[model samples]
Target: MSIERAFVTQPVPFADALGVLRAAAEESRLRILALLSEGELSVSDLTDILGQSQPRISRHLKLLVEAGLIERHREGAWAFFRLCEGRAGLVDPLIAGLDRQAPPLSEDQARREAVRAQRADAAQSFFARLAPKWDQLRSLHVPETAVEAAVLDVLGPRPVHSLIDLGTGTGRMLALLAPRAGRATGLDSSHAMLSVARANLERLGLARVDLRQGDIHAPPFGRGSFDLVVVHQVLHYLDDPARALREAARLVAPGGRLLVVDFAPHELEFLRESQAHRRLGFAAEQVAGWLADAGLGAVETRDLAPTAQAEHQLTVTLWLAAEALVAAGAERAVA
Candidate 1:
């Protein structure tokens, strides 16, 4: 689509169109937009790739954000910028028109790859340092492939409109289910973990998946904002698993569902000391009661235990619960 056709079909207000054109009219800002079209990037990433000062890059980002040509997400001390969904018609066409192989655009692509390579290397180092502990835990479960397949089976063939994965480590769950959802988001408290997730998702061309660095205890979203909510292998690390479940339940829209994947009750005390697990595991009734307290109903639990030969290992449990649609409807009616 051409830039003119984008504005003509979308029919943005005249002032808005002018602002967008002004934002992209600049040479440096245009390059930034091209780089962002590939994936989300921080100001530092753009600065390094464009070889411009931090202040200059930030100024350009601010202008694009204000013009609605891009959007910014602040995660702790760092902020990431990406193409704005509302203005994609305008931005995508403009980026598509770029002569990618010519002049400064070619140089920018090379630098972008170098920056991404460094990011991947740093994320790999972090994972490498913890791989032994992670590997030990994995060995105690049914193979992850089996657990993932079970999760899919539990979800069935229903299409998800919007999904959020709490404590999204490595973004594996988001990648697994995103293709079946209209939009996907992943949240983790650890910035390092989010970086690892970002690299993994981007490599798989799932760059549009929103990755936010946030606490599971207090997710940064309004109640009932998502059609589906997932809490995978995260409850064990929390001091209060029930509280996290309540929070996860709060995000489920009316008629939507929550999926919890974790280990069943176990005597894995060593996990507390070695892996910093706050809780060993949870029982079926224990989690069901929590979901009920959160106003979710129709709870179901499935267990996937290690093979008979590996009985000493932990049993992975999957819990599915639905938001109380009648209650939600009544509340809406009352309001």
Candidate 2:
């Protein structure tokens, strides 16, 4: 292979490279690699797509995992597999060499689309059922366009290296900000919501972004993992918004930022009962205090109030905070 076309990672030893090629040499394993090149899929998904037995597909996956050609992550009882990013230098060229429009590969692509289409249909039905309730709440606030514009303005025009959306409902923020992010991930406690997000992202061809079933208060990522962290329209549902902010802030890298979007203080009692809201809208000072306690500095706030024509609507607030670079330095110094 030409040097320019090779994978851009630490050079692999000849022996290890041979092992990867050996594991991927088989016909079925080659097809699996091609399928996963599109997105992550479960064992069941592979069986359905390839029209193969579960045990047969599982065995191939095991070899691929051991060979470091693929990686697997478990969610509940099910596990999903994808091409190992670390192995991209080796695997990418192999998949790229495949003639996708050829017989077996083309057939595999058709079956894969069918599987994803089924998932999309199911997720759409679930969202359709809840759409009315969401629409009702949306009407009670300033338009989403206004809030999104304010959010964009607050974050500025620079693209971030990495971003995580805490409680990413339907993956809206992930999709919106994805163009500006080199890597993006969304975490939510609800598996159903994640399913919806997965389908939505797939339709948008954003298969590169990762989605996981995880809690916002205790996210699975390591400290200082992302350049930007966002908590949008989620704090009102939590009993301890401050604790959640602290956890989200922990993931912000040095010199990174955290952006929060939610409703300002309001006397909306019905929201508590009907919407399962744990708290009414938050006050500006209340959120700033939480951000400060979380070791975030240079806090900036913006409020988007309902227009005069919509007097009864709720006001949406945006809070952008910078990671305390001085605090991070001092801690490292002490350590």
Candidate 3:
């Protein structure tokens, strides 16, 4: 592969490259970087895979992070690390050049899988406890088949460069839209939910998709970063739905679109009480107004109501909005 295609990082100063070289020169640190390129990992996980003391593994991680080769974020009680995006090009080729089948990497990879299996089991247990309730409530809503079809119709056949799903419960939306996006990310507040998403994606072998734990009101991604943003079955759960809508709008790049899926006004009082739903449902006008105020043009709205045979079923509404693409050209002219 060409060097340009190997890593997606921007060029850096000479000192920066020297610093990266120095940081990766060590044995343990090199192994740590190589493993991180595969996926994010925690200190405990690294320790387990390396068969070394926690302190030793952490030291190597600290050095790599200090050199701007990796990034760390706290998820509940655990700290997880991944290669830093800004400097990934520097480390990506280095890690790629390693002999995967030789030395400790082969053995370390086996242990890493074992550690991840244990993690998946714990996360599945949490989901297992909630599965019964989920299944019962799922039947009350419109079938996903109709909703998914509507979403794809609105998006068309062209591939989007980047896609993001807010409140990406179990990563269902990500899986549905993966084929439409060049790279996709699913965000959720619960680590347990993220694990469920990870497992779902892993089963499908969707290496292009990523799952991150983050807030709906304050997502970690940059503004105008995603060409397609989805808010699926999430607004009814938020106390400030307008604020969340604005946040979702902020992520849509120029010429991009946002799709929101939720109940179209219901009298489900029990859902509010039992399911922690803040709003029973939303009116089409209310949602359109929210999208308008967030600087998005109202493209189209569709409703998928149940058939006469299912009076108890809830109707699901979809709203599509687009950000004007003029800014992209203007920015290019200025450059």
Candidate 4:
């Protein structure tokens, strides 16, 4: 006798559901909700916590309110938003899904968080003194136009698909090279620096660029993920410049280029302490050796701007190197 077969049902289409769910799935939005779940938050609190523009954060909150996921109340000139208790029917499921898909906080993430907290404190202190006289303070250093031109000359016009800018202070290098790349990620130890970088990029209306906070000696991304990597004016700040260079090399894809721009050897002890710089400067041969140790070839070192006077002189140099890719036939033979 033939038995009747039981029917099995297909799973729900997560792609379609996620599309609708993602309306509030943004990183900033999620963080806002999570924070608000604890208590009410004004726009300024969100700006400080998420390090986002007031307009951008407000837009996300509005979307959440429209979606019936959050409730907002206006008192005088300030507006506060919070997660509605029973009214948040859809938000519960979204939060549950987000919790499941959230990236784990590893040791590196913890370290970065500590660094960010410290940097935020330091930046607040620095800005408290310098914010009012920002123009004057900025003018004390080299002109931004000169720095931009020097960066462009160092990057050249080569096509770069995936790039990383280590210690990407204000993301100047990433902004310059992002147009020539398929994707770009900036890594920095200071959350304040990354915040400035994010704001700068957003002001330019740029997308597909990621900014992460982490140390240069121990970055968070995987090995060999970038087609081109840059460390601009950052080597002098690292405790171990050689180790940081090796870490940068680990992120370079096969045949990818690595460009380092910084000052030549010098004696700048005062700046080293006050600015938290670990080294004064690096030599060309010393940098080349680090690149070779990291499995890179075709190393080229050149000076960009040299000082005219003997006493009043500041020389800049650029070190370029590429990872040597192995042929498929050679790999097969060796295997």
Instruction: Give candidate 4's TM-score.
Output: 0.59
In model 4, the Cα lDDT at residue 116 comes to 44
What is the descending TM-score order? 2, 1, 3, 4
Candidate number of the best TM-score: 2
User: What TM-score does each of the candidates earn?
Assistant: 0.90, 0.93, 0.88, 0.59
lDDT of model 4, residue 68: 59
lDDT for each candidate structure: 0.87, 0.88, 0.81, 0.67
Tens digits of lDDT, candidate 3, 125-182: 9889988877767788766787888888877786777889999888888888875566
Off by over 4 Å in 4: 1-144, 309-312, 326-335
Model 3 segments more than 4 A misplaced:
1-10, 207-210, 324-335
- Residue 51, candidate 2: alpha-carbon lDDT: 92
User: Tens digit of lDDT per residue, candidate 2, span 79-133?
Assistant: 8897777888888988999999997999999999999999999999999998988
CA lDDT for candidate 3: 0.81
For residues 1-335, could you state the per-residue lDDT of candidate 4 as single tens digits? Answer: 11111223434356634543676667667766655543345677666666679899889988877755677754346565766544344455555454523343132234334544554465556546645544542333455567667667766787777889999977788777776776677888766666566556644544336666678988877888888999988887777888898999999887688989877776756655556667777888989898888887667787644345333344567788877563233456778
Evaluated at residue 316, the lDDT of candidate 2 is 92
The residue pairs that clash in candidate 2, if any, are 7-89
Worst 10 residues of 3 by lDDT: 1-10
lDDT of 1 at 226: 91
- The residue pairs in collision within model 3 are none
Tell me, what's the RMSD of every candidate? 4.4, 4.3, 4.3, 14.4
On lDDT, the stronger of 2 and 3 is 2
The lDDT, on a scale of 0 to 1, for candidate 4 is: 0.67
